[model samples]
Target: MAVARSRSSAGPVGYAVGDITSLDFPDGHFDGVRCERVLQHVREPDAAIKELIRVTRPRGRVCVIDTDWSSSVANGFDHLDEDIAEFFPEDNDPAAGRAIRSRMVRAGLRHTTALPVALRFTSLTDAGVVVPFFNCGAMQSRVRAELIERFFASVERSVDRGGLLFAFTMWIGLGQVPLGSMPRNVS
Candidate 1:
């Protein structure tokens, strides 16, 4: 038998642990929506986003935070291209989730482009924690380790030159639902 996970009172207001595309709530029921690290795993992000906007009230804020896998690079690795190819066979680049913005826009959302942020690493262990998941591979752990080493070396060099400059890139997109009556058509 599986144990049911209880909802926490400290979580988001009116939040439900369910699918976004088929929300149980009525139309225009939300005042604001914040989605983080969700779209990447979604099978239909566009539809899910549409659901978000549909439920949000007029002038409501919609914020999206996603990571681009394709933009991430193995620092100081000469064969970065080949390494990346071996890493993510599905999408041969670090720009994972980058195209989500346009999809949102086409779905009638007015959102900003993905913003880049930096995550600083103090040690190889820290890099190790992220590299495995980011690389998305179990068979390619050796390659991931090599990349992590190179990343740490670069960070150390940068720190030596300027003292622990920690940064990683991520995109934060914000948009708004136009305040208007819901359309009569519910497709």
Candidate 2:
């Protein structure tokens, strides 16, 4: 409701709740399409990419922004990586950010470009806003609550000891749909 109200205040903008794999829009309906942080959760990211390209007009731009969770680094946390993997699992593409550019190119988009943006946090409180594992309550059901508490405690101690660091990379991919091409099923 807030998003709808905000968009309405901005101007005329169309918004619909629909699946990415099967968009309701007609072929070449939009001049440009942008998707952010959506592919990582989808079961078939390639299909979603195809749909984004499909609805875009010829020579239109398709931009994707996603996070590469595999690139997450923490200097003070010893089991941060292992815990993240255990919580998210292999089925989730933690490296989706790095793979989006290639996926766009393979989908027949031209002039593909990828850029990486690093997000650095010097404190656990800052990282907690984005990384759920940093919040004890978020991981309480999956892992032992005491373990999560200990981890945060250790992180706090590390910060006091001047050994705190947290960084992750997010990638942006930009591509242009080829001229004179029609949308096709990507399956």
Candidate 3:
């Protein structure tokens, strides 16, 4: 956030650290709202989406981008992937990305669209940035060190043979707030 605040030159653009599920803004405060890669980490993603819709003006756009960790796939590593898939939700909301569009519609947003983007990784170093299993150094307390080490050992071997290929889907959901006003608490 400090980096973002430093790099952004637009004076009208303001940044504040606040809760997503319960923002401090009033209704129809912003023309448009966007949330990126945040829902999957929150305790109540639907509430966050509702809050996003609540703050945007009628007919304004709201966009949410998040990862569908369930869509993760690794070439020649299906077993390991399955193990992690079950384990991921113990720590994060792995299905948040795929659920965004429907949630928006359910929250009364119109013209909702969801687009899936495949993020492919060929090297362990690059995949480690986003894929938790690939980063052994992170979340050492939450994840079993032995499992991560074993997985990375296999990944390293596969990479040495030039066969490590993994990918996951990220979804971008966009919608417009309904032109007709409804009670903010209804959604």
Candidate 4:
């Protein structure tokens, strides 16, 4: 409702809540489609990517932005990476960002390009939004309480020494639907 009200003063803007893997739009309905930070949470990211390409008209563009959580790094603490892996697990598709480009190409998009973007944070609180292990409260497990506290203590020590650093990479992929071509049902 807020978005609708906010855009009411501006020119026409459309918004619909729908499944990315099965978009309701007709084939070649949109001139451009863009999805951000969503594929990582999806079970079939490639299917969603194909759907994004499907809605775009011939010669139209498709853009996707997603995080490669496997590329996440925390410089201040030891064993932090292992702990994160144990907590989050690889089944989350931590490499989704790095894989979208190839997925788009395989789906028959032309002129596909992928760019890696490094996101750096000096504050643990800020990094917590993207990396939950950075947030102490978010890691409340009876078995791992001591380990979590120890990790935060190390982070604090690093901050005191001015050595704290957190970084992760996200990828932005762009592809163009070829002219005179219609997207096939890749499902």
Q: Highest lDDT: give the candidate number.
A: 2
Off by over 4 Å in 3: 6-12, 77-79, 82-92, 182-187
* TM-score per candidate: 0.60, 0.84, 0.85, 0.78
- Evaluate model 2: give its lDDT: 0.85
Off by over 4 Å in 4: 1-10, 86-90, 129-153
Candidate 4: TM-score?
0.78
Give the per-residue lDDT digits (tens) of candidate 4, residues 1-187: 6766776876777778899999999999999999998887688888898889889999999999998878877787665765565565455576789998999999889999999999998877787887667776667742277778788888888888878888889999999999988876566
Per residue, candidate 3 scores C-alpha lDDT tens digits across 69-126 of 7788788443465446545556468778999999999888999999999999998889
Using TM-score as the measure, which candidate wins?
3
After best superposition, candidate 2 residue 132: deviation in angstroms? 3.4
TM-score of 3: 0.85
Task: Find the 10 residues in a row with the least total lDDT in model 4.
Answer: 82-91
Cα distance off (Å), candidate 1, residue 39: 1.1
lDDT of 1 at 117: 67
After superposition, which runs of candidate 1 have C-alpha atoms over 4 Å from their true positions? Answer: 1-15, 76-96, 111-113, 120-168, 181-187
Please give the range of 10 consecutive residues that has the lowest summed lDDT in model 1.
1-10
lDDT of 1 by residue, 102-164 (tens): 766766765445566656554444655664433324425546667655644655565465443
